[model samples]
Target: MASSSAGIVTGLVAAAFVTIGVLAHQASVTAPADLGPAHATVSPAPGAVKAPRDRRHPDALPAGSGTGERVVYSVDDDRVWLVGPGNKVRHTFAVTPGSVDPAPGAYTVTSRSSRITGSDGVLVEHVVRFTSAGGVAVGFSAAVDDAAAKPDPDRPTGGIRESRADGDAMWEFATIGRPVVVVR
Candidate 1:
């Protein structure tokens, strides 16, 4: 009788473990809430995706301009796109444009400065210069204070302003002679 009781207890413990394992496996593969059969999202790891609404800029270029790894700037929309070698848009973000805009054509990164006072009298970093507009060096930068206000018209500047993090990405991506394509 004791042997039978022991056997029964062992069987129950095994069954409990099997049930727990199955439940954990199911949880790992469970699908997320669904709006409908046509639109259901899986529970992905954190930071795996950008919000659906923000996937692409509303006014973004349908296709990138330059070939190979390069930066594409849209003068009309005040947006910047970093294109990879395969012509994939690695990153896209908005930038505060300066008064002077670059011509709609191809240019190459000419110079870079880690930190400098912008022509607008604002300190900026990650300066990636490609061209000059009316003697003012045109480049991308992030304000030292990390402000995102529109360019100060009174400042009369052509310093394309971006967020500090975006500037960092631009700095790393656009070295000297990297192609910069400006489009209308």
Candidate 2:
């Protein structure tokens, strides 16, 4: 009877290990090629309908940011805009982008952390993560100490740094499943 019980326990443990392995494999297959295994499960969707943008101004919210409440990040401008209802601009600010930029498309906010150590080893707060790029988790965060400095070019990171005030606004505005649009 003792030997039979031991065999049953061993079988359960082996089954659990096999299940874990299968799950890990599935996850790897679904992740984007550039994002690696740590990427959020939600892949970036097609680009939003673009509105005509004014090439002259870098500050006025770029055209084609999409209507309704959304967070828009411009890879070229290094700017962020928190848009509200009726396509009104609630807040606009500059940001220090990370080494890797997500492609120009639409993604939903996948997760958030109030305070945590960033991939660059800096203490950060109000981390609003939307997508992954270049084998790293891409998100917006403010340095806990308010530094909001530029990231090291040598490191492959996706942390878009923002001011503390801006981080606060982003934390409040961008919740899970919120639309995040990446423009030029």
Give the per-residue lDDT of model 1 (tens digit) for 1-184: 9999999999999999999999999768632222111111112223422222234657444452646788877766778988886777888899988877766556779999999998877889999998886667788999989987477666557788899999999999999988787765
Query: 1-184 in candidate 2: lDDT tens per residue?
Result: 9999999999999999999999999766642322122323222335623334677775788765667788988877788999999888899999998887777767789999999999999999999999877569999999999985778889888899999999999999999998887876
Give lDDT for model 2.
Answer: 0.81
Instruction: Name the candidate that leads on TM-score.
Output: 2
Count of clashing pairs, candidate 2: 1
Q: Local error of candidate 2 at 6, Å?
A: 35
Give Cα-based local distance difference scores for all models. 0.74, 0.81
Which lDDT value does model 2 have at 54?
A: 72
Q: Which stretches of candidate 2 lie over 4 Å from their true place?
A: 1-52, 55-57
Q: Least accurate stretch of 10 residues (summed lDDT) in model 2?
A: 34-43
